[model samples]
Target: MEASEIFENEDFLWRLVRHLPENSDRNRFSLVCQRFRRALLPFRTKFLFNCERYETGDKVIYLQFDPEKPEVEVTPIEWTGLLPMLQACAQTFPTIVSLSIMGLWSGSSSLPTNGLSSVLLHPRFAHLSSLKISFFKAGVDDNFVRLISTACCNLTYLNLRHCCPRLSDQALHSLAGGCTRLQFLKLRGHDRGPNTISDFGIERLLSSCTRLTDLRLCVGFNQVTGWGVRAGHALTCVVMENLNHLESNALSQGLQGKRLKRLSLHGAARLGEIERLVVERCAAEVVEELNLSGRMELKDGGLERIARECRRLRVLELRGVHGVTEEGWKALARHAEALEDLDVRDCYFFREDCLRALRENCQNLRHLLISSYFFLQQRSLETFCNARPSVTVKVYHREKDYVVDERVGLSGRPLGSRLGRRPTLYKDPVRCYKVRRFGYPWFEFLPFELVSLGIV
Candidate 1:
């Protein structure tokens, strides 16, 4: 066969595009020719529409893989032009499974009275399985959510952020009644909203979405006491952050007996009895990742209980927790054999004994993050480094506002080795380097980026 004939074969091109790993590579491949672009259309599943208002006009830059051409367009349109843009996208990508729309609100200008109804009520988006809407200054309310539930009945994942305070339990009820296939849901309300979604709404949604496995309620939802989460029998991961009215008993009741694999309770200040209840009931053996950061009531007793019960725990974050002492470290070192990543930054009580315990017992540990407040002697840090040459040790010096890697000495070489010369110091005292571990300095707890990347 001729070379052109082989290249023009649609079946071969489709097979080739399927093997491309990254979206960038596939996009570049599609740009090769119109035939390649046509072959790539069926595989295009994700679309991102980001609208930004400039002094010139309102610019809409959307990532759409049009079979006619692979080039993206930057069009200037009015605020009302959003509906037309979405309509064009739906017609172009009929097989789209995931969609993201950001920056919908155009400054102080009010949205149309119908809200997103004109954009989301289209029949072409019936196949969409995942939807994300964020950064709306206004207009998104219970009516908008109800439209989503009605339009996207097959949606398995939904994320809503910074919506209006008027979005009450009625929206959740609508979602429960319409989208029963939901498996992942994230709701982050505006910072200055009345408590719109209380335990009642949460219970209704959990009971209706029987397949839900991951749920995150962040920043708002102050009225939620976490008691309604018990209805989700299939839940494997739960993140509840900044919920001020979260009661210990309700949270404990919700968590008990569920086979959770990951749990994060950030800013839950009143975890008095819930600490023991969590370790004993929910996280005994199945939980692998746990973040209890900023829990002032968590003491050595809670730590010891965690070490004893959660034997399979791999990632543990205890940042800003000061109540733990040397005794807690000893218990963790003795039992947490599967521990690989540990963050204890800002723990003023962390000392030399704690370092010794970790260095001697945590054989599987690969990443250790700590704050410089405890100020362990340089000799002790060097000893720990020499003992665990494979481990990545990061110390955040709050005073200098820099990070130092204990694994590398001042000479930028492995700590145990000397290059036969005095170490040279740089002119700048502040040195910063990115930690490559899964969950590290950038994210004090679980890395939410994994969710966006579809890895978790």
Candidate 2:
């Protein structure tokens, strides 16, 4: 067989180096065939090797450099270590569109001063549309922002979360100027300067980016509310109106029906009287994604109004909020049957009754994130699951204290296992959050000597 013929054969290529322990083994295999060589290209784009498994079976790799021993074992993708691979990937996968730098494996303490510049300045990124960067503390200097704006002219989607002290109104202005064709812009929990994105700044961006469909504005700021609740501030009322005016202008200019689909105002606690703002300018029918996190000032009626108006809402995130009761959830369930994702985390007074109501009405519910303090009404949960077999619940453990069930006389699981039982995958949020490094025990709180309740 010709060497090129072997490399081109897709069927046998994966099997060739499938059992090879080392990633380097594939390089040697590639020389054997052209198909193998082509196969190696994809692997280079995404590396699956674990650092721990370098010597043994199924090793979990660590991307980040850790000095102090961590509480639990972690498999984080270190961005710096994978720079060479990323460059190769960029070269090989020039047409690659979406890029998400997420998880512990894909983050850096500081923005890659030179590395990022290359990517943004490269002609490759100019054609790209979507980019997501999170958990990085980088000074988004003027030069860096300019570089991005100059390169990412065609970008339509952008998400920058926890990338603080770098982004400012100047940066946003640059992006607005360059990415005139932007469709989605998410600035989550990022600290921009005072008046960085004021009414004028917002008007500038919104008017320019007529194609924007989704916008998320979350800014963390200290404020002494008249009511004494210290919550973060979001886009000002003036800015929101400016946005509305900009949208209206865009519609007048050329865009039809205002293509704006989703608008998120996360962690804007200081923005009092959200209801009036929503009622006054925001076209509830067009807005699909509404995120109100840690905004204690918002009342139940405000939420009710939103449900009544925003009939197209599909994703609603209400995290760390108050004043929303069971009735509010019920109201949303009744109105927004299209709601697929509902996050009610850290709402102190949020009751189990709301969950039951959600199960009964929101048939389209797919993703529900609740706080640890929130408990699933066992009967309601079972009934809901029975009714909607596809629903997956992701509950974050907040409460450790438990009381014995009055009827069953025991807590958690029932007295004994059923005839045919299955192993449940229960994760410990406490331990998971505490884990600093790898080699940590999976079940830290469980008694090692406890006998199994299974019918073994």
Candidate 3:
């Protein structure tokens, strides 16, 4: 049956919406649904009502969306049957775990906060495992934070990105004290002026709430040095930036001997901070995925250490670290036995030999991103690709710097001349040669040949 025919059933529709990704534009989906049903879905799981500036690529995306008149107006008088719907949902689905509401903008005017706040702060949402609120620029301060913490005792994931107003150390302390089960806490994209988040706040939050496995703080720190804070032993993923030597060392010391799976310090450019040293110390054996994309100070020795220590690494990103030579690149055969995804895009010292070795040893390696050094010749590219039937390799091109369309390598050889026709390296034929002859992006260019002939 056709997809359009299958979606006619309401059962399928509700199931689809429930499984639809959280980041999907529900507002747009609701507008489309207006054609099918006169009103929105009223799913009770997710509802978005806002009048912010909307953009889809180069054009505005909302049909009945006027900047002055957003469709769903949330006022005390004009509840638009929403309050009744919520009451119905609460009666039906006793323990709905996820809820989110994005409120007013800086310039855009708002509705009555009391009604929405009352519904959100109710006992119905006490068992909520996840709560994500953003852009509530009205007045979601200490009281709101305090209320959420007190009510949602078992909340594992709480993300208040870009929604802090009058949120102070008091609110953070209250949250840490109250919600002991919070595992994923992200409080980034906050307003800089009113928000007072420093080492003290972070330390207070982490020390008390010891169950966190994924913690991300994109705010600036003050007062307390790095050693003062203690991220719990259960933490598996951490994305930290601009951490000094002391803080990095302290964090490493705390997380030592733990089963840390993902460690991302992609933006730290400090050479003298001993941050690389911290990496060497912390993720010795257990870490499965690591991202040190732009740390140029990491030398061949450090790369060797990672290869030696992290034997079970599944994913490794060394995008801009150019210090590693063929020795370090080839050393992956000895260690990193289970390496599946390897990104060495801007590592200028990378060669084709590394690919040959990785193919022979690491049979499970599925994804690879190599530098431009190997893209000079089609034979070289094909040789590496042909060896690994299960791998997807994409050669990096400087999209901005290099003017020519990077369909094919700029070898300057005439497209016809190589296969014997004419002597001209112009646009159409060269691009065809690139897309067909030399595989671009997906090395297996055509599907028929890709499977039947085994990854051509």
| The candidate that achieves the highest TM-score relative to the unseen native structure | 1
Task: Compose the digit string of candidate 3's lDDT tens values, residues 333-373.
Answer: 55778889998878867766766677778877888776555
lDDT of 1 at 356: 94
Root-mean-square deviation of candidate 2? 11.5
In model 3, what are the clashing residue pairs, if there are any?
226-247
TM values, all candidates: 0.73, 0.59, 0.65
Model 2 CA lDDT for position 380: 50
For residue 25, model 1's alpha carbon misses the true position, in angstroms, by 9.3
How close to the true structure is residue 103 of candidate 1, measured as C-alpha lDDT?
58
**lDDT for residue 448 in candidate 1, whole number 0-100:** 15
TM-score: the better of candidates 2 and 3: 3
Single out the weakest 10-residue window by summed lDDT for candidate 3: 51-60
Instruction: Tell how far residue 149 is off in model 1, in angstroms.
Output: 0.3
Off by over 4 Å in 2: 1-111, 119-126, 188-197, 220-260, 352-356, 371-377, 387-390, 399-456
49-137 per-residue lDDT for model 1 (tens digits): 22212222334443433343222222323444555555655565545566666654463234422635675667766767888766666
lDDT of 2 by residue, 268-309 (tens): 435556654454445566666777666677777888888888
